[model samples]
Target: MDYSEAIAIADDVHWVGRYDPGRGLQCNAYLLHTQAGAVLIDPGSMGDFPVVFRKVLDLITPEDLRYVVVAHQDPDVVGSLPVIAEVAPEAEVVAHRETARLLEHIGLRIPIRAVPPEGGFLPLADRTLEFVATPFLHSPGAMATWDTATRSLFTGDLFGAVGAPWSLFAEGAFESQLTEWHEVYMASQQALVYSLDRLMQLDPERVCPQHGSVLVGDQVARANAHLRTLRCGIDRLVSA
Candidate 1:
């Protein structure tokens, strides 16, 4: 398989993100095949889109796209949106209202289906996608997408691991890397705790973050538990 290859991560979900060895960033994106249509989660940065989009085309064409789900307004997550919008003009942009506002602030005028603060649902032909509000874990309007059919959670930044050399699916404990990433990227320990608590309630079978390997089985629970005690912001700085 080439660099622009799609790897199956779940039933019908493919990991279409590209790995930047030079930058040690996974910059993950996902192609979900839903009954209604195909959904691209976190299309990734403009620089990474060419490879990501090529991999996506290996599974489905641009016309097959139905929605472009935005976890947050981060460029790494949705920066290549102009290209995506041009190719898949019919794909409705799904994101939190605040995210929509942020995108608009940047002059992105594509159609948006904003999720409420409490979060909302996206009805696919065969399944309903649950959007859960996870505010300030990293971004103010951060939201995670839960695929009930596959029991996978698409967390924007929560549970992400930095550096490279990780597989598409984690084989062992990634606690150390996970901790390192969160301690610096996560806004505050309080925000992390609240978001982690809410995310854990879902008990996801797969934990897919925007920047790291997919955590599966018991690893998901362990990461959540480990994250609960993590300190960020002033606490981490003071301790250091």
Candidate 2:
């Protein structure tokens, strides 16, 4: 659980989260440095907070952390809100409208910048972060973030896979375990397809999911193609 070293993935973007094989699954949190500030995406579960923060601190101080982007309301996604709030006291939260409401309901007293149903963008001092709504893909308030500068997409749970900690960049074929997890968690086939189409349009160079390794290069396109035909939620229920 000691993810002491922060791995630099792209220009100013670092994978500063822990990878715990003991859990047999893990999530990735990223630190994106901007011109005047920094943004942390999906700070991760409570157990991951200490290690995540330690790695992140190497890149930027907690005080300079300006934005905490929550991709959804899932515990694995935003469970460390309290810890993040403590460290990045001045950081504003950016999430879907419903997610913002959930945060308030949970007694998280932080400034929220909600992304409307149609989705929107957050302007940092250095670049812009685009929010893409992917409702019911798993969570009703699920969303994905695209860093304009790095052309990297931070997908909440959209392209997640389950396995031992793998390569940071995805290689080879899409694991069967990944497709299986999606079949159970994604709320509906329609939602999955819709979100897939929208994300494909963005054509991100890298796809970073919360629970799995990063998908880069040709794997990004291949994964999207695979997701389009896969059935989930009600579709799987009927088939079952």
TM-score of each: 0.95, 0.94
Q: Could you tell me which 10 consecutive residues in candidate 1 have the lowest summed lDDT? A: 231-240
Error of 2 at 75 (Å): 1.0
lDDT on C-alpha atoms for all candidate structures = 0.86, 0.85
lDDT per residue (tens digit) for residues 1-240 in model 1: 344588888999999999767886688899899879999999999999899998988899888999999889988888899888888877889999888888876555468889999989988988889999888868889999999899999998888888756677876667888888888888888898888788788989999999878998899888888888988755666542
Q: Report the lDDT of model 1 for residue 101.
A: 82
Candidate 1 error regions (>4 Å): 1-3, 237-240
Model 2 worst lDDT run, 10 consecutive residues = 164-173
**What lDDT tens digits, residue by residue, belong to model 2 across residues 136-239?**
97889889999999999999889988775465667677666568778888987799888888888988999999877788888888888777777887786654
> Which stretches of candidate 2 lie above 4 Å from their native place?
1-4
- lDDT at 54 for candidate 1? 89
